[model samples]
Target: MLKDSFGRVATDLRVSLTDRCNLRCSYCMPPEGLQWLPKPELLTADEIMRLVTIGVERLGITEVRYTGGEPLLRRELVEIVQRTAALTPRPQVSLTTNGIGLERLAAPLAEAGLDRVNVSLDTLDRDVFIRLAHRDRLADVLSGLEAAHRAGLAPVKVNTVLMRGVNDHEAAALLRYGMKHGYQQRFIEQMPLDAQHGWKREDMVTADEILAMLGKEFDLTPADPRERGSAPAELFLVDGGPYRVGVIGSVTRPFCGACDRVRLTADGQIRNCLFAREESDLRTALRSGASDEELAERWKAAVRGKRPGHGIDDPTFLQPSRPMSAIGG
Candidate 1:
């Protein structure tokens, strides 16, 4: 098992397949998006598979999450999932997508051994969705979620980033929509990961505020906590309801101590934390024909120095140099 200095075992690996996204989310990337990494620089499917194999075989990683500026935009995504699923222990495979492209790809991805999906859907209001995502694809996203559910991706999850005075007003409505469609909604507090570096503490909707907003419409109870796991969301049951909602208070109530995940950008840089200021370049080493053992050692070195916490509440906290799109959500 790969245990960091803080004793947090690394079990989850988030791989960003591409830095190009169709939508320019206000809280994620700049309006102009970004100059994406050249295709030649992006890690190939074989390289990604090799890294996943090493993580699973050597580092005790058991969960492989495919992320991106939008993972669905990656052409080889299903192939990546298929290969990762074929590993010895067969790590649980999942994806986080914007859902605009999911309607066409969900069934194929599910058939390729994807375990589940977390779709980004911040609002059902067309105007709000357009204003936030810089796209008018709310209906497309909704259809994609339904497609994923129909394809047997059980318990499809929705990731809603709540920005104060923006989409926070839709808290109850979003929850109700998820509940109605049998989707588990997870409200995430906007962090300092925006491309513009414009995150303000007062603009973030905290977990407490999210609960309070939902309390206006439903009776919620703390759900029985699952086994201590790497997944970040904290779950809660809607009183008298069949489904539950989750809250990832990344900023206000950071879960740094229990973090067991590491990240790999599309360009093959290993980031120990979402807010990590530094990253180890894995692409150069991989292209240099480094042996699997050597690659595994590189991963270990990165984890050994993982920061204890994100320091979101610290007065001296600084936003990451790269935006969420480049770092992978």
Candidate 2:
């Protein structure tokens, strides 16, 4: 297991399979379609698989999560999951998808050893959905969620980025929908980080306010943060029922101190933080004939420079040049 200067061990790795997505949520990609990573510059399936293997062995990466502009966009996704699942000690394999291609891919993904799905569904109302997603098919997303449930993707988590004027008001409704459908709906703060030039401070809805809104409808109590990843969400149990609500405090609060995740772009650069402009290129090392041990050392060296936190906490901190869709959030 590799340990960083912060004494944090890399237990989880978020791999972006592709830097392409279908949806353009305002908080994520804004109204305009954002710039995309050049196709040739992105990592190929084999290269990503090799890195995953190294991450599991050398970085103490116990869980592998496939993320993307939309992970499903990569045709080799199922195969990638299959390969990662075969590793010794068998890391917990999971994925975060847009759910557009989920209807057709969920079952295949689960059978190949995918353990969970984090579906991005901001609104239940069709008009609101289109306005938020820049797409007209709310039905498609719901169908995909239903299909995921049927495919044995249990505890299916819904990721709703709550913006003040946009989907923030629908918090209770979204939670109700989750409770009825057995989904673990998480309301993420419309953080300063987005695909646009800047994240409006006033546009955000804090975790406390969102919790109050849901507390009005359900008897909510805080629960422990889930697993080894980022605690973007505050987990809560609703009364005595089965479902729960999670709130991500990326904006009002940041959790970079305990952040164990190492994000690998679909191509082969490793980013220490979401807001970091500098990245270490690993694909070059792989292509330049770096051996497994050499590559592992490179991974270790890159991880040591991990900052204690992100600059988002500072008022003068500028948003990264690229948006969420391109960054594989």
Candidate 3:
């Protein structure tokens, strides 16, 4: 088990296939976009599978989430999901995408053994989406969501980031939209994960505020905490029972104490924490012919050093050098 000094064992792994993204959300990167990793620097499909095999067979990973600047951009993603689902004690495979190409890839990915998906859709309005993502792809995203649902990706999740004075007012409407379409709505508080370092606390829509906004429209009762477990989202039973909504209060109501996630970058570096300033390089070792055992040990070592919390409230906290896109969401 990848047990940290804090006694938290990592069972979930987030793997970034590439740092390239199709959308340039204002919160993630500048309109011009940041420099992407060269093709040569990224891990090959074989390399990625080898590491994933080690994690599942040797390190006790039970859930594998493929992420990226936009995971749908990775050409080999279907193959990756197929391979991951074939592992012994097969992990629950999922993808977090901007939903650009998902309209076409959803059925293929589901057939390839992808268990589910989380699509990021901030607003229902096309104009707001254009202003936020700097792209006119809202139609593609909605179509993708429909495709994923039709492909039998049960409990299709929609991730929304409510920025103050932006799409915050659409909180109730977004939830209604999700409920109407059988999609689970999750509102995540914006964190300081942008490459431009432009995140401001005041500009963020806090969890409390989000709940208050929804409260006015619907009666939200906290779901059984026992069911939440190590999941980042704090779920609420919408309209009494059955249907639900979630809020990931990453900054205001930190869940780091129960965090069970570890990240693998496209370049094959291990990130023990999302906000970590340091990384454990596995790409160099893999390219240099390191044995799987050695690589597993390195991964274990990385998780062993995980900090207790993200420390955003600490005066000394520094935003990670890699943006959310590069960090695999």
Could you say which candidate leads in lDDT? 3
Q: Evaluate all candidate structures by whole-model CA lDDT and list the values in order.
A: 0.89, 0.82, 0.95
**Which candidate has the highest TM-score of all?**
3
State how far residue 225 of model 3 sits from its true place (Å).
0.3
lDDT of 1 by residue, 251-313 (tens): 877788888899999999999888989999988999999999999998898889988898877
- Candidate 3 per-residue lDDT, tens place, 8-97, comes to 999999999999999999989999999999899999999999999999999999999999989888899999999999999899999999
Ten contiguous residues minimizing lDDT sum, candidate 3: 69-78
Question: TM-score for all predictions?
Answer: 0.97, 0.95, 0.99
Residue runs of model 3 more than 4 Å from their true location after superposition: none
Clashing pairs in 1: none
Q: Tens-digit lDDT track for model 2 on 1-329?
A: 66779888778888888777788877777666767778888888888888999888766899888998899889898999999999987999988987998999999999999999999999999999888888887898899999999999887999987777777788899988988898988888776556666677776788778888888878987665554255566677789645667778876767777777788877788887778777788899899999999989988888888877788767777777756665666
Lowest summed lDDT across 10 adjacent residues in model 1 is found at 222-231
In model 1, the number of clashes is 0
Error of 1 at 169 (Å): 1.6
